[model samples]
Target: MASLAASLRDPAYVFHFLTPSFWSFLIGVVAAGSSLFFLALRADEQGEHFATSHNRDQINEAIRAMPEVVASPKRLADEANQGRNELIRQSHEKHARAQRAWARSQRYKVGWAASLTISALAFVLGYAWPLAQLSFFGAKLLP
Candidate 1:
């Protein structure tokens, strides 16, 4: 093991130790890419959930307005159109709320995609820049 120890102390051995190979760099790039992809997917899923909840709220509001709309339609229609007017107002409000939720969801999706893209790009550049270097002589020596 004395020979092995002496070889490890050599400058060539140390340099090789410091330098990484193309495959190692590729592995790092792949890992970063997968992580970014997962993050983007997660953000999209949350956005979908938000949209679904907003729709449900709108549906519930409409259902609640049903009984009032059915009760005394003839009289209510003439009395400042009470039930119909209220239903229309509630419908508009529910639509506005759903619109707002959709807008927020879209913003979240865009931000998540942008962040993931930037992170993946950074990782790729970091790995590729050093990988381009070609080692000579002691490059073949195994640490």
Candidate 2:
């Protein structure tokens, strides 16, 4: 047991501790988590858009239900049209926000995939390459 501990302290063997694979894997996991978080945010945004649309529909319905005694016919028509235009504008803005959130989630997903690929390549170079060198030449190629 003591000999095993002593061997672990050797510089060449300890090189494994400093390998890029561990760092890259951590980054990959963080990126994947970020992607998921953004995806949830995107869903929230879409739900907001749906709520906005519902509100707009309700506002339009209310405008249409206004009594004839409220104002002149032409004035009431103009007011109702204005209300509808405003509601449509608000709905469009909410939809735009949802689309932007979706775009952000997609970017994070791509980053996660890239980080994982880099981690895999780093593992091969940092761990496998050293072992191969040690087996064939009785010495590692890198520190």
Candidate 3:
């Protein structure tokens, strides 16, 4: 308790406490936490996509009947439908490509695991480095 008070009074002691290992541990934890957060967002989006993908046909049909398209003159109705059909087809192709990419990312779970593992290692290094330094210098704990 005295040492704690002494260190608090002495700013130099603060530098000793903020070592490279401590910084590395802090960076690692923040990076890992961010990765986990993004991973969760990806999973939630994937779930929502999966739920909606099944209804894609119905969704496409609904889009085809947009107010502007439906309110076109009778003479232009056929032309509008033709153009809308082509647009919908292209959109479907793009959506399919996106879905494939999402599937690939989900299949590769190693990135998240690797980040967590590296952060854990950093935490261990941070905890051990100070003790190792103290031992090497034959420093006695201050009472």
lDDT of 2 by residue, 1-143 (tens): 22332466464554453444446445556655665665566566556656655665675566567543345687776675675566556656755665665566566556556655655665455555445655886764334
Candidate 3: tens digits of C-alpha lDDT, residues 29-132: 88689669757766775665665565566657766676445545776876767766675776686578558757755754556667777788888887677677
Regions more than 4 Å wrong, model 2: 1-5, 8-77, 137-143
- Error at 119, model 3, angstroms: 1.8
Question: In candidate 2, which residue pairs get closer than 3 Å at backbone N, Cα or C atoms, i.e. clash?
Answer: none
Per-residue lDDT of model 1, residues 39-136, tens digit only: 66666655665665676577667767565433365775457446656666666676676566566656656755665566566656545544343233
Of 1 and 3, the candidate ahead on TM-score is 3
Using lDDT, rank the candidates from best to worst.
3, 1, 2
For residue 119, give model 1's deviation from the true position in Å. 1.6
**Alpha-carbon lDDT, every model:** 0.56, 0.56, 0.64
Worst lDDT 10-window in candidate 1: 132-141
Off by over 4 Å in 3: 1-14, 56-98, 136-143
Per-residue lDDT value at 100 in model 3: 73
CA RMSD for every model? 7.8, 5.9, 7.7
Error of 3 at 84 (Å): 14
TM-score of candidate 3 relative to the true fold = 0.51
Estimated TM-score per prediction? Answer: 0.45, 0.52, 0.51
